[model samples]
Target: MKILVPVKRVVDYNVKIRVKADGSGVETANVKMSMNPFDEIAVEEAVRLKEAGKATEIIAVSVGPAQAQETLRTALAMGADRAILVQTDAETQPLAVAKVLKALVEKEGPTLVVLGKQAIDDDCNQTGQMLAALLGWGQGTFASKIVAGEGSIAVTREIDGGLETVDLKLPAIVTADLRLNEPRYASLPNIMKAKKKPLETVTPDSLGVDVASRLTTLKVVEPAKRKAGVKVADVAALVDKLKSEARVI
Candidate 1:
């Protein structure tokens, strides 16, 4: 199996985000960047497939600015055979991203394409489906469990009601969920090895995909802070507060 996984660079989860003064985007000035959490899960899953001998090659593909090479390196350290960075400076929306990935898929001719269900920053949850649509291939999104077969794969999907299983043939797309697998840290040795791996860079223009933002982020503001509450001294006071003051009862 030739598995292609798309990774993303986003602000570190622990870092506090500040909106840009012009309200165009988030402030990246001096902010720490890391691989998106969900993308990490997708990378781990792809590596697992390779370790199990189900995958013959794993390529980590990242679409962003030059800084996105860092995200591809992170995936390579996790065990990808190679990396591809589709260089784009503009903030790409789901439609644009899907188009670029589609071009790569045609070029690589991979059997499987795995990606995160959504990018942490945008939470769009649209790329995987869009890619599948663009390629006219089937998709298994929010996959909690995956088992490879001779020619098809069995995947368990997490939905609103319950888990559902489906068998998808090769040349399919799978979007990973949180419970897919626990991502491993890239050790120092792997980091050194990743630096030596073959990383091919391409531009969106080179691939004939126009990089334009269809969705615009008008404004971003911090969510209102939650109010703090005091604990009642005893059960009687709690009951009184709920019944009289709060008027819940």
Candidate 2:
């Protein structure tokens, strides 16, 4: 089985986000960027599957600017056989990304496509489901555990109430959740080897898919600062504050 893993580049979680002066978007210039944490987990899972002899090849793909190749390289270093970068400067919304992945799925004919449940930059968790819909394939989203069997894969997903398991046929989509697994850091040797691995670049136009942005960002603003806590004389004061000031009761 060949597993296709889609990774994304985003601002490192440790970095503080700054909105652009014009409110166009978050500031990316002179900022640290790295692979999406969730995607890292997806890549690790794919590598584990391959190591277990369940998968033959693991292809890591990214849909973003040219710099996204770094993200794919990280996947390669983690154990992806090869990497593909869908080079595009335009902002790729979830739908556009799904369309691109769908095209690749048809072309590559991978047995499974694994993706992160959401990108921290946008927090939009729609790509995997959209790709499954486009491909008319079974989907197991927010998967915490995955077990591969002959011609089928069972996924244990996290739900509001608890966990739900579903068996999906081959050629399906699975989105990795936070608790799925811990990702490993690439060793120095693997990082060096990743530089020599095949990294293919393609454009959305070549795939004959339109990647125009559908949503408009009206403005971007920082969250309001929290007020410092105040001390109260007694329970009566706390009740009064909750009833009148906070208006909770």
lDDT of 2 by residue, 137-172 (tens): 999999999999999999999999999999999989
How do the residues 75-106 of candidate 1 rate in per-residue lDDT, one tens digit apiece? 99999999999998899788899999999999
TM-score of 2: 0.97
For candidate 1, give the lDDT. 0.93
Which lDDT values do the candidates have, in the order given?
0.93, 0.96
Give the TM-score of each candidate: 0.92, 0.97
For candidate 1, the per-residue lDDT at 236 reads: 97
* C-alpha lDDT (0 to 100) for residue 111 of candidate 2: 94
Position 104, candidate 1: lDDT:
97
Best by TM-score: 2
